[model samples]
Target: MDRTTDTTALPLIPRAALFGNPRRAGAQISPDGGTIAFLAPRNGVMNLFVAPRGRIDAARPLTDERRRGIPGYAWAHDGRHLLVVKDNDGDENFHLHAVDRETGAMRDLTPHGPIQASIVKLSPRHPGEAVVSHNARDPQWPDLYRIEIATGRSTMIAENPGLAGFDVDEDFALRLAARLEGDGSQTVLRPDGAGGWAPFMRFAPEDAMTSGVLGLFTADGRATLMLSSAGRDTAALFRLDLETGEATMLAEDARADIGEIIVRLHENTPLAYGVNYERNRYVALDPAIQPDLDALDAAGIGDWGIQSRSEDDRFWIVGAASDTAPGVAWLYDRKTRALEKLYDTRPDLADAPLAPMRPVVIAARDGLSLVSYLTLPADGGSAPRPLVLLVHGGPWARDSFGFNPYHQWLANRGYAVLSVNFRASTGFGKAFLNAGDREWGRAMDDDLLDAVDWAIGQGIADPSRIAIMGGSYGGYATLAAMTRNPERYACGVDIVGPSNLETLLATIPPYWEAGRSIFTRALGDPATPEGAALLRERSPVHQAARLARPLLISQGANDPRVKQAESDQMVAALKAKGIAVTYVLFPDEGHGFARPENSIAFNAITEHFLAAHLGGRAEALAAEEIGRSTAQLLEGAEILP
Candidate 1:
């Protein structure tokens, strides 16, 4: 077995190049500022990678081959153990585990079958311990449980029937518990030492005007920041004084949806939080007062965030990215504003002189504004090229002008891709997001059509060779577009998208029990006859018989949100009608591909599918570029002529 094999003989990588996949998350900073940990897929899957603190430190893998969705882990107070959580069953039941920093000791904290738990906080005083939240007692709601690191013993700390979440402060204390009421209202209950509960803030159903009740980001002693989705107002961040019960508006935009910060490096201090508004924008927590944010901002130099920040907060890290540079590691200097390149995530893509992402604002047929990102072939835009209408998931999620892999892939293949931030998208005002409510298969799908027309109007897209692709909500839209309005898209690709809105709303996982509140507001009540009918009318499945174009569907076998049955039903119905459809399922993945092999494999399959139909280019598949699963898909697929 020669360690040196011919990588060139294969499709993607050099034999000498590192195999397996790199991590998907950014590197993390240790509380002591002496080390950093990041996600890296070493043996064909993603895991944690740690490195010593300094200008130069060789990174080492901290976590071995493990299950996915463990991004919700943190370091204990002593920073000697990494507390991790994994969802064993398909229902998203999480089990907590402890990993020792010095000896890489991996131990399960919760051993119950299909028991669901979450790591709420790491005790600052008790080195290798953490405060966990689980619904072990109640399947409907969760409470706090203190877990001992060495032993798998858990003690009941606080139990509240209405508790939805718990947060511990820097002192390892369970300071706040967010309880959800039946009426979609919320209450913040503070922990009283006497084991009593104190109400700090209460949000009523009518107070939907100020959803400041969405829970607050309570730092050790800093004021809490609430992310509110007030009516007709876009979601924004608000600062509430925990002492005075007073709230101050920190950031708001009637035209933008604001996001909040849940995690920060070192003492979990609030540093720079990110908000994807009208475009991609990051707001630091007054970097002037705290040099850490500024230093972290400059960590790798440029505007990139480093894997993590230091404890003392002298030097900060920023991750760097560009059109040509998918993700490059850099160290930025706060004092001198100097940027130093550390490593490039995808060095093999150096020759990809990709074009920058540009913003475009077009009026919906109804005169409403829609924001979109326009990516064209690098050959100086003006020419009309084939177009790919890339719909994004979370129709609630906005697409800013940035480097998106899918967008680049489509553009690189000589097709202009248009990703529209339709009305339901956040970052805009509440009205914009609300405009998308209940419009799923109707106007929302219209917005996508309108975007294609805009590309035609801009003379950038060849209307004849148009295609549409997306996952989840986007996948739903892809099917809806082909079903609701048949002649618009030449080809449709749905990835883990719901075929029926009613089924999706009803079959939601237990962990997403609270999502019903927001879903009801956005999608109406699915239990009611009227809501059921409307959802059916808007469902792609209900209109599957109307399909006239080729379709490609991909789904995760264990996806809790978008059930595999969604894809199964759609495919069955389509094939039942004698329609040609391609389907792929990854048993090891969840909602999205957590492993790089999955991504590269899916990308290769998608490219081949698109090229043969759209008459575009398909980059030669490579072994190291992905895994055997990816190559298998391309083996028999018809390549572009």
Candidate 2:
């Protein structure tokens, strides 16, 4: 807990370098292992780039995305084409595009309009085609399709019968489907060979989110792999017999869920699996892959993971990263045992005075243990510093230790940063996750308060100068913190966070209808009187009059989940109460800022705001920073320097 280093002499790290586009990232090796594809800035926007193996200098942009960058991409089994998904301004209605590596031609395979398209399965067994799901036929449920990658022709393979998700096999055949029942339980179904589906397995409401069928384990489809927490607190990997409905445990962790399973290419067999508690631990299941795992562990890299692998399993694109560093991708050759560094994700940060992140477990007021991370200023010397309690979104998602730009950025600006994995966060056992149900602003907010109390008790935070900041669910927590305990925080920042749970549930996207029961069960249902009362009592917008701290709110105008109205309503509530609040809006953004300019611009404003209230050191804003971004200061522009 002692942070006694003199970090005050270090030069300020630029906001752009921390939040801007990376030079190169998300590297994926082609199936044949002859080429590597990654994302790099093209004309200031992130685009897909390709290069021959070991020839990153000769990389060329394959997809020229001018506006919003391509979020993610994958290589087809043939390796002649790449598939990328794009959504408009963060609307989350993703459309699948196929880019020909040979001709640089891009074709929208799912050009059906405004529907969310996701790649279900791609395999070497079906190199010519891919199985995809889209809500084109019905807005509420997505139907499956077999699409030709080369010709862009689509054929309906299966119609969704109100199912939440489908599991397709290596041959692009539907093997199992899961449906969310009205009480928030889940039922897995298998095709009955007569064009109908029969129940394969049923999960209780408590195990709904923690357990489900992963996919078929074998090529014959007689056996499947699943994650089930039905009898245990933590979800475990199991090999289920499709014929007998019997499940045999493959792997389990006492502290965490089996988060990831690494499978062999085309065969769909598990080679290794990972469980993350304080840090990630990978266990090799196949003897043939044990040496490879050992080599990575001995490579002197910090927390490495296999990003991409060739069909033959001889070559792997491994990305190694840590809390203080961005990421470095290495082309690992199994036969040669050679680890060749391909590129640094952010070479600009190589020599920066970055702080170290320490994982700590704090006890909640009610005796629950909260896993948290603390990052102190690199030069902070035996003195309590201003702290920013940074909460993560997903209220369902847990924060893990890694190269977090926000942590580094805040610490560089003379502030201690703390991120807590509160109750209800996944990866922990089901008991911890289910405890968060309907807690939202109640016990969940209590967890954040307890973390702040721990930081103060450890002499790491100046309690009077503390701030609360986050996006989505995190944003909601920020607002709740400032309102519920107005004296606890000096300032708060909310990015795309909902102010009213009732409206948030009402405005959810149509495609999410199948999982409505899950939301209702976790959050209070607005349809029932008691549920409606609970939601109103927990909503932050209703308690705006209690807000005693300076607040900054930002929103992506196109965000489909937490719509602009969420921010608008909060700002309006503050205005009606004669309170001053700064509001920043991006007309072309959704959910979160995808464009780097906007991200840099928002942080530029945020730093100044924090500096004013929390007395933290801040880099002066540049005219070019604001000019380059599409940020519209809807209110309180005078708050910026």
Candidate 3:
């Protein structure tokens, strides 16, 4: 395979401009509505910043994290403190940190190293405390605790006792838990007040993921908001009575599962819930909030989300997103029905030409509906152009309509990007998700091939110029596409993808032990001889000798999910087979590139690789660009040049 050496004079959007850290993003309002808090760069690192509600310009930094940035945070009921989650050097063992906004003091609430902490519930009734879960006691399951914000003290609320999840009410009290059974089913348990728990409901393995609790209803402790796929193809939002096991449907979509619930902070009442099939759509449940929803819809710029609301629910900090416009924040004053533009996430791309992402549905060879998003180059004529078949990571996760930086970057480089939600994608209900079970490289890969054929039939993609690229599971699919149908893609790129399913399952993080049964049911139970043979048959590493196209691979050294060994073994196999490949490794990152410099460098090399194989436009990698990041080229050194 020969690389494309011809260079075009098209304007090159700098890699840093697309992949560098956002100046400021994710703005939210305080509970009292007196101040707003958001993430912004402080000393070259992202930190918590707060400002008065009406005067966001006076925002000041509250945390001085210098290495990795805070991933997420929430305001405490008192408004003077906030809870944040951050992982060390991308190891993914997140620690909960409580910060004092007044004195800029911070304490690690869960200081146990490599133990993940997650918020189970939070309420104004417990002003300076939150129900948190920590897996320090057991790597396979987490135990619940009431963590105090003021003293960083923790009181054990509920021990894991071999349960998968603990359900809490509006008062931050644990009421129910889902326990994984030996048969891969789940038994929902309710506490009997005397410390013993009894089964309330049982879900078969097929229905476990489709049916789950949202939270206990604020109006009635005995009733809870739940999602159930029982007696239906798609999951629906329902108010379920715990005592009688009766349920009433609230909001539902024929084609997708019920998504997240939007709740009022103090009152704990649900305002609306979300559904995402092609794009995200909200179903308003509370009539009082309908007018505010209408005003946000009328803004008509992009998808709007309520970031934070005042206690009285009069003022809302909203975040708007569009395919062309990555992000923009607004202050929506509900009383006046006005949207005041606050800031642009990427002001540099404000004027850059971006392609429109259109949603399309194509039927697979097996007649399954495949929902996909396509973004074509702005200047590329209505003819067959180079295509990048970008697959999403979660075979369990679905791709939605949104502003994706990768799609924009590839489109600007003159390639049509197609991201397909193959059969197993969520939100489409239980049947579609179930169809992906045990079909890893078979029906799943066929669906991707069918998508390419559809694009070629539509004259939107050049069949001879198509390349496959993805991360994680999508990365595994990239390897599968190249090996199973070597004549299809011109080249391929895989990031943090597992090559051998057997080793992949065996090396899963210890903390994921509780969910191993789900994986076994979804893929193959590698613990059995039959499952071992099936996994080996589907593994791309075992079929490396059939590789017919060049490949680019990237892996993070510290990735906790898809370990670096996955990439190493695949590359070793390819090397032994004398197959063409480039491998890049990041020393200071995990699952994916978290640091701005590492992200920029990875994308730069990737752009260079795509241009070499597909003849697309690329910003030539400069020496300084390569020197700035921690990315080390392990093989195929020509990818950067």
lDDT value for model 1: 0.68
lDDT of 2: 0.91
Candidate 1 Cα misplacement greater than 4 A, ranges:
1-20, 23-25, 55-57, 66-73, 87-91, 123-127, 172-175, 179-210, 213-223, 229-232, 257-275, 282-302, 331-340, 620-627, 630-641
lDDT of 1 by residue, 65-144 (tens): 54443455676667877778876424466788888777777888887666678876654456666778777777666777
Give lDDT tens digits, candidate 3, residues 1-641.
Answer: 33332224346666777888787898888877888888988876789999887788999999888887777799988787888988877887889988998888998999888898988887777788889999999887899999888888899988887888898876777788888776678788899888979989887777787888776565557688788888888888888787898888988899888897887655456789888888997788999778877888888869977788877777888888988888888988889999888788888887777779999999998788888999988774786888999999988898888798999899889899999999888889888988988888989999999999999999988888999999999999999889999999999999999999999999898778878887888778888898888899999999999999999999999998899999999999999988878999999999988888888888889988888889888877787777988989999997767
Task: Report lDDT (Cα) of residue 200, candidate 3.
Answer: 90
Which stretches of candidate 2 lie above 4 Å from their native place? 1-7
Q: Please, what is the whole-model Cα lDDT of each candidate in the order they appear?
A: 0.68, 0.91, 0.86
- By summed lDDT, the worst window of 10 consecutive residues in model 2 runs over 1-10
* Candidate 2 TM-score over all chains jointly: 0.98
Candidate 3 RMSD to the correct structure = 1.9
Number of the top lDDT candidate: 2
Give the local distance difference test score of model 3.
Answer: 0.86
- The candidate 3 region of ten consecutive residues with least summed lDDT is 1-10
Tell me how many clashing residue pairs each candidate has. 36, 2, 0
lDDT of 2 at 244: 96
